[model samples]
Target: MIRIVIVDDHPVVRDGLRGMFDGDDRFTVLGEAGDGREALAVTEAVTPDVILMDLRMPVLDGVSTIRELRSRGSSARVLVLTTYDTDSDVLPAIKAGATGYLLKDTPREDLFRAVLAAHRGESVLSPAVAGRLMGQLRSPAKEPLSHREIEVLTLIARGCTNRETAGRLFISEATVKTHLLHAYAKLGVRDRASAVATAIEQGLIRRD
Candidate 1:
């Protein structure tokens, strides 16, 4: 079973998610928090395998909370559940280390699947977000990217094969593909095009 903490400012939302998870055999909601600071404290106290985080809590908000947790070396995989759909809101959460982004309206089963995937370090982003992010990465930057990621995205944008990005980056093709997946998750995009666009927008990589 996957142990999880649910953090949202709404008691109703928390109750609903708890009810849903309580009915599942593979997951159990272990704790609940209505604010970001409480979420952090509860998570640190219990150290669950996953956190279902709401975006707009009063004290810290979802993005900063995730960043704080990650900065403090907490390994709980964060899966964001919020009503926000804009790229600006979602992308910041992703960049702050959320493993997934989901609308509050997500079906219970699908939300469960996303949570499970996040426990395994996979991400969930809407297709439209994926597109806009890639489109945005086609700009200039200041943040540092791994040499390997640079090689991969540059090649990907140029239409290089995964095998080709791998060859040029001097890593296994599988490794190149894996890095792209992480990059995409971190960039809050889905494919190479969106990854490139969002990376540029987020300063994870460069542009002319």
Candidate 2:
């Protein structure tokens, strides 16, 4: 039997998943957690073969938890099971070391198959998620800058210092710097001037 740990913020969802797996002869429900932090603890203690993870939760989110798990050298394969299928949700989780991404609405049999595939160290993706990844591959555009990163670039183009940008955006100066750093990395520019210029050239922000 494959050992499994379910991670979801909702108790009902956790119970439902546990019941589903427990009813299956090929799988065993080893543990459950309400959020990512608790997931770390529970999975550490139980050492499950596969982890069913949710994307959104209090304390810590799924992607961060997956990264933490990988950093700690845990051998458990993570399989994301969440309601969200958007690019923002799917891309990060996959990049953070999820073995599979399945929508919550996946058929029971399909879910079981996905878990089996995950245990075998195979990649699994819901149809919608697979399409999104395909679209990303076909697109020639660079990684899109987030809205907040665009806001930071817009402020910088308007001659705002990091401190001034923080004041205008109602965020901390450190946060302003962090956004700038992210923007720089995404835009492939090393400094503020180049970031602003690239954002303008790409039409991500207004030159005026």
Candidate 3:
């Protein structure tokens, strides 16, 4: 049997998932967590074969938790079972080491098959997710902002001035200004306000 741990903030969702998996002979529900922090604790204690993770939660989000799990050398494969399938949500989770991505709307049998595939170290993607990834590949790729540029914009969004941002980043104000200019050019915005707004809209930065 494939040992599993369910990680979702909603108790109702967790209970429903547990009920579904409990009846299956091929799988066993090891435990459940309401958020990513709890997920870490539960996974460590149970050492389950697969983790069913939700993206958005109260304490820590799924992608960050997955990264933490990898950093700690846990070999449990993570299968994303969330309602979101946007590029921002999907790309980061996959990059952070999720074995599969499945929307909450997936059929019960399909979800079971996905869990099995994930346990076997196979990459799984829902049809909509696959199509979105393909569409992104076929479209004209916009110049992505660099890490420094994003940092600068994120600080600016948080109401940091150039000097303040530079001080926080341990750089000169001129360097911060340069990063901002680059970010503006890449985002096709003319000013700081517009750049921040555009970045937030494009999911490049979190909205404060």
Best by lDDT: 3
Residue 130's C-alpha lDDT in candidate 2?
Answer: 97
Candidate 2 vs candidate 3: the TM-score winner is: 3
Where in model 3 is the C-alpha error above 4 Å?
Answer: 145-198
Best by TM-score: 3
Q: How far is candidate 1 from the true structure (C-alpha RMSD, Å)?
A: 13.5
Candidate 3 local lDDT, 1-208, one digit each (tens):
9999999999999999999999999999999999999999999999999999999998999999999999999999999999988788898999999999999999999999999999999999999988988987898878999999999999999999999999999999999989988888887789999999888867899988
178 in model 1: Cα distance from truth in Å?
Answer: 47
The window of 10 residues in a row where model 3 has the poorest summed lDDT is 196-205
Scored by CA lDDT, what does every candidate get? 0.84, 0.92, 0.94
The residue-by-residue lDDT of candidate 1 on 1-208, one tens digit each, is: 9999999999999999999998999998889999999998999899999999999889879999999999999999998889876656777898899998888888887888888899988877655566666766875543456777876887887778998877777789889888898787666678888898876655455565
CA deviation > 4 Å runs, candidate 2:
143-149, 152-208
How much is 58 displaced in model 2, in angstroms? 0.3
Q: Count of backbone clashes for each model?
A: 9, 0, 0
Clashing pairs in 3: none
Cα lDDT for residue 148, candidate 2: 91
Query: What's the true lDDT of residue 187 in model 1?
Result: 63
Per lDDT, what order, best first?
Answer: 3, 2, 1
